[model samples]
Target: MKTLWIKLLLWGYAVFSMAPLLVMLLSSFRPTADIFDDPLGLPTGPDLGNYAKAWTEASFSTYVVNSLIVVVSAVLLGAAVSLLAAYPLGRRRFAGRGLFAAYFISGMTLPAHLGVLPLFYLLESLGLIDSLLGLILVYAAGSIPFNVFVLTAFFRQLPYELDEAASLDGAGPLATFWHVMLPLVRPAIATVIVFQFVPLWNDFFYPLVLMRDESKLTLPVGLTHFFGEFQNDWGTLFAGLVMTTIPLVVLFVLATRQIVAGLTAGMNR
Candidate 1:
């Protein structure tokens, strides 16, 4: 009886979570009229036309390219900078070490909005305001704090014997990090990549504020253009949403094992 209730609960939760996606998928196929008539029913047959229209008519291809640029650049830069910065903080003892760590860690606690106005001015002076590079820089900076914190903890947990052994072998600090440490932290690196990249890909606010050219708009910002002042095109809007989720879903599926292993390593250790 307990097992039966547990299964029932699991099934119920699954349905609750998936029901909306199922409805959206089905709705994408049905004639808009059919949607008004019976939203819950499966498509009479696959319309597939909605996807093509959403892909071409909505200019999603360009949006996809822009989003990829922002996400990939941000994640790569964020991970590299955080890893380098965290290493010294985690491994070395030095004067003002606490203050330096606090400076980096403080960014995690402060609300981003507080910096937005100043950032806007700074970017404007640098003439970076409408550029993809500007967005990449902002995204990378915003993600650095938490990534640094995570990497710092992970680095601290690593055996210092490795560093000492490498030093005795006449390896420089850079050589030790490159040859000895980084290879072992691939799992943590994968975790940071997924965590940072997903948000950077999905972000809408920065693009809404920074991207002025429609051609330069990322997926989330471009999707908004599909909705006009007087009318809402539910079919295409949902199709755009579906398109946005595909890349993220694919990324999650491919990296699920790596992400799970890294997270679980913390528990098992």
Candidate 2:
């Protein structure tokens, strides 16, 4: 009876959590008049035209490409840079290594708003403002400190004997890392990729600050264009919103098991 009640509660919670998303999905198939007439009613008939109009009219295709480019570039470069920085911090015992590690970790606690003024000026001076490259750089830099911390923690837990044995076998630092440590850390890397990529893909603030043109807007920013002060096209707006949500939903579905396993793998270590 207790187990049945728990399952019932879980089902109820799932329904409550999914209510908004279900509404949005249903609204996408509704005509504007039907949406206003019956906000919560099941769609009497399905309409695919709203999605087509939302895609073409709102330039969502462009937004998707822009988002993909920014996210992929940032995650790839950020992960690579972090691996390089983390390995040394985790494995080496140099003078001031603790200080350096603290310095990097300190960035995690610092607020982005505090640095926004200087960052804007710096980007403007470097001619990076209003460019996708600028957004990518900002995302990559923001993610680096945390990624380094995570990767470094994972690396430190690794057996030193493995590295020492490799050294005995005439392996240099680079060779040891590429051959020994990296392969062992694949799950952590997957975890980091999932962790970093989702936010980068969904980020609205950096792109809003740096991208001025409509063509360059990412999905989150692009979705905003559907709202007008005078009137809101709730149907099309909700349709576009549904479109924005699909990619994230798909990614989570595909990576849910990996994310869980990776998280526990790190914890177990």
TM-score of each: 0.90, 0.89
- Which residue pairs of candidate 2 clash? none
In angstroms, how far off is 140's CA in candidate 1?
0.5
* lDDT by residue for model 2 (1-269), tens: 99999999999999999999999999888888888899998887878878887777768678888888888899989999999999999998899999989999998999876887799999999999888898889988998888998889889989899988999999999999999999988767877888998887777777888789888888778767655521366777777888878877887788787777668875655
Clashing pairs in 1: none
Best lDDT among the predictions, by candidate number: 2
| Candidate 2: C-alpha lDDT | 0.85
Q: Single out the weakest 10-residue window by summed lDDT for candidate 2.
A: 223-232
Candidate 1 residues lying further than 4 Å off, grouped into runs, are 1-8, 229-232
Candidate 2 structure, TM-score to reference: 0.89
